[model samples]
Target chain A: MNALLEISGLTKRFGGLTALSDVSFGASEGAITGLIGPNGAGKTTCFNLITGTLPATSGTIRFRGQDIGGLSPHKVVEHGLARTFQAATTFPAATVRENILRGALLRHPLGLGAMVFGGAAARDAERKARQTVDEVMEALDLTEHAHREAGTLAYGHQKRLGVAIGLATRPGLLLLDEPAAGLNPDEVDRFATMLKEIRTRFGLSVLIVEHHMRLIMRICDHIVVLDHGEKIAEGAPEAVRDDPKVIEAYLGADHAK
Target chain B: MSMSATSSAPAFQPMTVVWIAGIVLAALIPWFTGSVFHFHIAIMVCISAMATGGLAVIAWVGQLSLAHAAFAGIGAYTSVLLVTRLDVPVLLGLPAGALVAGAVAFIIGAPLLRLRGVYFVLITFALNELFRLIMLDIPEFSGGSSGIAGIPKISLFGVTLSNYQSVYPFALFCLALVMGLLVLIRRGQLGRRFAAVEENLALAESSGIPTAKTQTIAFTIGSAIAGFSGAFLAHYVGFISPETFGFQLSVSYVIMLVTGGRLALWGPLVGALFLTPLPEFLRGAVEYQHVIYGVVLIAVLRFLPRGLAGLPRQLSRKGGRG
Candidate 1:
């Protein structure tokens, strides 16, 4: 399958320290790719680079065969590549519905004149946006809590809201940084099911960075392992999991047992 | 849970009904007052309300700007120049001032909006100083420190608005227009984006909101409104001066906005109404007038962090619990 997102020779350096060194990876279209690594492995940094929140030191990031290496975050989103941070970042002061509407508005922007005049075009855009918001809320099971402030949501629901925000972008490629990070075991299982359901429904590619091995292993079609900013293994989940380097990277050399 | 979501109040309410009654009373003020002094104070309040309205709009987008009065100055100078030098009518020239101010704001804001928080505030403060210096240095056009005098009275369709009676209605109309524009903006999608950007920039950007553009839009609109107010000030007083629009004026506008409530729709209106005539009311305590003003402001801010607009909510909550 053709890759929806392709990161090649991606490197990020912080003065003297190199955070991501010549990392290369690809997530195929409509596939759930898991990027798993220990702490200080540059997983979040890589996500930031691809999402255009952080500048890359070197290399190219191709989304749908177009080089989008240096676009601004919003422009990157405009190109149909969206991401959620490791921490669930929602507009705390806004309600869940409003937060989702913000994302929906990206698809159909209301210009300043339209905003002031409120004619048929603006009304149509708003109606479409509200519909999109409703659909997204229902898909993420956030309908009941739609009117509540996003900051007041439970930890698990906040994570779901983060995913819902990304979904509202209607992205061709969704980058989720630890969507299952603070989720409980049952919630993690449910999240994996949700990811699969979303994939089947939307037919969009997902690149997830998660420390939850059970969730990642269960849901990911392919797995990539990174250690100290370098790619260590990449293949089918079983192949990468059984790789000696992956075992050594996680357990350390002495604990190869 | 530090975030305080705005109350989900329905579109129409008892408060709006009260606002309409207040407007009616304001319109009838000229009939009751024979003295020009009373009309002058009322006009001052209207202009201050419009200027503070602009400040409130910028604050809505999560920025505090000290250059608002400078924008007013731009409007005053531009409109005055167009009317005196180029023979443009007051109606065309007034809006022209706002447009010029908005244009300058858009240009400056594009680059400056990138600076967040205190740095943004500092840059805008510098901008206010820059505008003041430009006005003082360009005496050839701005009339220097003494300022331009004998600004012609507004003549609309052969009805010369020369007296307090004539000017009061126009001033009231302008204030109404500013208030209406602000209310419309607050109730729109654009306003949602502004709040979202203020609440969380990273999240707002990831949600594909062009945060920079939103900031710029807010700043530009605020500047235009201030310019609109300033243009009215020029015509009402029949004079224009560098001293008229300065950092102190901007600070006063800020006080109005802060005292009114940062997030509430009517915050600035309450602030302008209360504070504009405060000095006149404090004439008996002239020696300690500013001191009294200081104390009152501090007390209000310390007790009512949401400004005077939040008073009703606070009172209701207190009553409910008590």
Candidate 2:
């Protein structure tokens, strides 16, 4: 399968600590890719680098043949790459529908003059945005909470709203950071189903950073394991699970024996 | 399944009618009493409201600008110079002031906005002081400490608005234009972008909204409005100096905005309406004027944190609970 997102030799360093180093992976078009590791294994840092939240120390992140390593976050989004945060980041005061509408409008931003004058183009864009918002909310099962302030929604609903926001941007690649971090087992299962449905429905690729082994193993077509800021194993879910390097990384050196 | 989809249609609310009626009554006050003082007060209210309305725009993007009055000063001087030096029409000078102020804001906003929260406010405060000092240095164009006096009155289509009564109507017309522009912006896509940027910068950027550009746009538009208001004030009051658009003036605009509603579309206007005539009403207790303002501000911040424009909503919410 063709790579929707391709990263190679990616590295990120703080003042004295290397958060991610020489890490490389590809999320294939229309496939669910998983990035898993122990805590502080640099999974989130990898997402940050790909999404342009932080500049790569040294690397190339090519999305659809365009280099997007150091682009601003919004510029990255303009290239059809969007992301959801680990903590369900949202415009807390805005309603869920409004939050999604904000993302939807990004696909069809009216000129400032057109926006103020209420032209036909502006009206058309507004209609399209409303439709996208409605569809995203329905897909995420958040239609019932559409009018509630995003911050006021239940934890699981807020997480779903985060994905809905990412989906509304019409991205070719969606990066989810710790999406199942706090979800209960049942909720995680529901989320797993929703992820698969959206993959087919939206025709988009997903790169999910997760700690839940079951969800990753069940849904991901490919799994890449990282340990101490380096890729330790890469393969199909079962093969990666059986890899001794990944086992040592997850369960420590003694457990691998 | 689409809850409140039809809520987009304009719904008749009793509070909306009440607000309109109250504004109409206030607009007719000078005419009813035939008081020149009342007309003067009304005109000042219009100017204050218009300037504060500009500050409200900057506030919407989640930045507090202490240099707002400096932008107004930039506008005031630009208009005064154009009218006096080149024989430009006062009508043309107004928009010229706005253009220059907006241009200045566009130039400075990118660097200035890099600083957030109190740092942004502090830098703007220094900029305001810098503006006053720079103008003071150029006494020839700025008229220095004593300032320019006996400026031309506002004239539209060769008819001068020579008295407070005539200027009051013109001021009202200008205020209406500014307020109309605010409404148009608030109801549009740009408004949503502004709200998103204000609410969460990181989320807005990640969602494909250009947060920096959105903030600069708000700053430019807001400063332009301030410029126009400053020009109008220069012509109406017939005197201006660096002192006129000083820190005190900027603080007053901030007070009006915070007291009115930082986020409400009508906050600036409501704030100006409630605060402008307050000093006049406290004529006998002149020494206590600022103290009263302090008390009112504290009361509003505590009780109606959304400011005066949010009063109806607050009252209704309380009533709902009962």
By lDDT, the best candidate is 2
Instruction: Tell me how many residue pairs clash in candidate 1.
Output: 0
Model 2 chain A is weakest, by summed lDDT over 10 consecutive residues, at A248-257
Q: Write the residue-wise lDDT of candidate 1 on B1-322 in tens digits.
A: 1111232457777866776677578646757867777788788889999999999999998999998899999999999999999999998888999999999999989999999999999999999999999989999999999999999877787687989878888888899899999988887777777888888899889889888988999999999999999998998789989988888788888888888888788888888887877886666775664565577689878999988877878998999999
Query: What are the clashing pairs of model 1?
Result: none
lDDT of 2 by residue, B1-322 (tens): 3443563536445776787688879989999999999999999999999999999999989999999899999999999999999999999999999999999999999999988889999999999999999999999999999999988888999999998888998999999999989988888778888899999999999999888899999999999999999999999999999999998789888888999999988799989998888988777775665676788889998989999989999998999999
What is candidate 2's lDDT per residue for A184-217, written digit by digit as tens?
9999999999999989999989999999999999
Clashes of 2: 0
DockQ, in order, for the candidates? Answer: 0.50, 0.70
> Per-residue lDDT for A1-257 in model 1, tens only?
58988999999999999999999999999899999999889999999999889999999999889999998899999999989988878888788988888898888887788877667877788677777777778878888898899999998999899899989889988999999888888998888888888888877889999999988889999998888999999999889889989988888844655
Error of 2 at A138 (Å): 1.4
* Superposition error at B242 for model 1 (Å): 1.7
What's the lDDT for residue B250 in model 2? Answer: 90
